[model samples]
Target chain A: MTEPAVTGTGTGTRAAPKLVLDNVVKDFSTRRRKTVRAIDGIDIEVGDGEIVCLVGASGCGKSTLLNIVAGLEQPTSGRVTIDGETIVGPGPDRGMVFQSYSLYPWRTVSENVAFGLECIGMPRKDRAERVQELLGIIGLARFADNHPKELSGGMRQRVAIARALAPEPDILLLDEPFGALDAQTRRAMQEFLLLVWQRTRATILFVTHDIEEAILLATRIYVLSSHPGRIVEEITVPFGANRGPSVLRDPRFLDLRDEIQELLTTQVER
Target chain B: MTDTSLQPVPGSGPRTRSGTGASNLGDDPAAPWRRTAKSGSRGRKQGVLFRLRDEIPLRHRILLAVIGVASIFVFWLLAATLWSSGNVLVPTPLAAWKAFIDYWQSGELSTDLWASLVRVAEGYALSMAVGIVLGVAIGSFRSVEAFWESPIGFLRYIPATALTPLFLLWLGIDETPKIALIIAGTVFYNILMIADVTRAVPRELITASYTLGASRLRVLTRVILPHSLPGIIDVGRINLAAAWLMLVVAELLAAQNGLGYRLVQLQRFHQVDGMFAILLIFAVIGICSDLALRGLRTLVAPWARP
Candidate 1:
């Protein structure tokens, strides 16, 4: 198949990528004294302001890869760098959203969002203002004083996103954030995420198993094979920044979706 | 009667309204069959009296509690009156009431109550402070856990009552020994319980804090401490009973005018009514403190479910 012409989206260019993972590998030691390889030799570059989705099946170590980049886990051999500096541990430069909404149960929506800012010693007034602004962007201003338990699952996930975004991290790492939501809510959240992306233009590294979700939200999609996960193919989504839900019916979207489905199924068979 | 019997069963018409949107029973051919089959047995009215895992109204709940307490009181009254033949071990309700009134009128009740409350407050407050510090340390860090684990394990097994004499020998016969005994009894349990609560804090929260650029101290103070606060308060509530137990033990051994010391005096005089009166005071105090701690938990951590 011929490659589609490069659009004006920021993902097309790779020069001085914002975040780079160089030959990253992770291995876990089992109780049987055997080393189990999780992901091997992953080299990925997410350009600044790009939405890159790592698509894979369960047990494919896609989350492990994201965690390595987030500095929540260390790679066994390779290195991850952002802005040319190697990441030794978790820092405020990268924000993370987990599948489980990790909002502090004790904190209100506003307090949860302000947590990171509080950690960085932002003054109380500034923290409140920043939290209010982010809540407005996420459209949860009315829920500022409400605890997480009071919000719906979708709303809580939005608050999680807002919290991660509060410190203004350079990169946003999301690990199957909408996996727990119902189908209808998931679609709504996908749109909300795109809206967030369009407004902030923050670089995002999203990991998910759903090919359709990948195609809908990603500027570039990296297909990963399971059982010692390795990158199998890198496909640039043909849609531009103006892409919408209508793209689901677009011929090109269907073709790319089928291609990824075929790639993943063949990987499982192998 | 015949027409009504032949008509579609009363409540089963709405029961078969499935999500398939077959709202008109006449339009669907299978609806009558479903209604007839379901109406025979499944259409019986369910009683609200014994709902499965359902909440009763507050007034009903209070009424039930009153009945329960009244039944216990009736049983006690019967036992005291009917079994009054041999030794008169159980005091009559009126006798116990009179004894309580006499003790109150003498003003000795206030003195003894004040003495016991002061000792408990001092020792329990000291233990809680120490326990929380050590528990947070032990729970948060491996080195601290290793340092304190074995010593605490060994010490907790030795009964605090057993150590009463030792405490007396070491700290002398003043309030020091009594306070020391209460601490010895409750602090170890508090430490272990609070440590477990701290350790139970979700790892994801700590990791999330780190990714948000929280230092270890900040994570401890901001995340773990607040998250564990409700659980710690729970631990305090449960262990307060132990503190009361130790208070009685400490006062029984030594010195002046505590409830436990008064109980010993009453026992010597065969004043079982006074003993029962003192026991009632203990019960009241226990219930009040438990309720207070529960209120405090709700106040500090409103996010936590009751």
Candidate 2:
């Protein structure tokens, strides 16, 4: 499989496109049965191991698109595929970490991280080892026995990420995962997410309304426009990979931040 | 909400020239909100007011409760025996105590207590089993709810006491009828409460589990059941009261060896002091059982603390 030609300043997308959204459309009916088009015809493919972000305003339905990909919601039209196979529903191949962290309040940190492993029927010994490794990486090993209520918002979200990755899915879907955190914690979590991505190499599809965040983490950005939401622009981030928080100070990062900001502000005719 | 620990307390240190540090504070837009970060307000939690209830020491609380109970007892003794000397209805605390000792010496108190406790155990256990199974099933499945919701709701409105004649006619004056009465009283109340809790289990947690590759059954077991655990205990705790309330109704008609029977028997003899003694016993039993349930709740769901 060849990489799609870089229409933006992005580097070459290599190997297979692990996730694909083809001609996706979603409609919602109100209490009065009035159909509101949440998403319009949209086609995008995530290259193998690529970090792709769908950035848009509130009504743009970026979350709806992510939900469809996660198999939590079915698209009104078109299909979503991962590794050339169509997804019918949520499976272990796609692990999702929601904005709410969604860590089981009843489970301790280690148990929450081991949840998917438990669901997939991993042996208890192996699951324990895997959970321990994940806890150490996310810096929650010391607090592994603590329940979600005992954890701060950021710590709970780190557990959420670790829990999502515990299943070792081919793709990780994060729906504004750091949205609830304070600014400092959100920044740290972004850095932590990159570290997790580097270790796991799972293809990520992160959805966010924050442009700066999209620029900081995403390899390629899909800017979605609202009012019958559709992709308005696709940007190839030139800052490349193996980045740290220092990359935020780069001129290219500033330019890209401004560029996405401009696209979001102005109405571009389709 | 301010981080008052970082703020210097007024008069704690020699005052510095105000304009000297004005330029440094000028750069921060949020510095104005920190003005309330006085030392006096340090470590104050948001949304909670300082109350006499909060500041009262625990030992004092216990002492105050004991004093309150003694005061009531003294008042009863004064009004019943001293002030109204010949009023038989007004049993003094000493007379009630004497009646309690008389019943205990006869061993009838222990027998009644044992009988009442056995019925509670049998009927309450049955209710718990049926309530949890049907509550979780009904709450998780729309079809199950559709099937059972209306009937359960309809039965809930009809007081368990109203079914006395039916229970007596069907099962006769036996332990089975009394147990059935208690079961009927507690089950549906528990079902509706537990089902509400199951339904209120967050949609997001369920979806998160599904994406983690959990089968429907796994989600039900690992997520739904455990999440609803505290609620189940809460239902049991609440329904314990309902269970005891029905205890009297169940024993009212033909209960030979229960606390309710002892109460009715004492009343027939116009032994007002004995009735008061039995009422005190009921209070103790009810309170002790409620405390036991609360202990069980703490043991079952260690994380759900107030």
In the order shown, the chain A TM-scores of the predictions are 0.95, 0.93
DockQ of every candidate: 0.67, 0.65
Identify the leading candidate in terms of DockQ. Answer: 1
Query: How much RMSD separates candidate 2 from the native structure?
Result: 6.9
lDDT of 1 by residue, A130-231 (tens): 999889989999999999999999999999998888888989999999999999999999999998887887789999998999999999999999989999
- Worst 10-residue lDDT window for candidate 2 chain B reads B35-44
Which tens-of-lDDT digit does each residue in B150-185 have in candidate 2? 998788899888998999999999899988999989
- Name the top TM-score candidate: 1
Worst 10 contiguous positions by lDDT, candidate 1 chain A: A1-10
Write down the TM-score for model 1: 0.89
Evaluated on CA atoms against the true complex, candidate 2 attains a DockQ of: 0.65
Runs of candidate 1 with Cα error greater than 4 angstroms are A1-11, B1-39, B42-60
What is the model-wide C-alpha lDDT for candidate 1?
Answer: 0.89
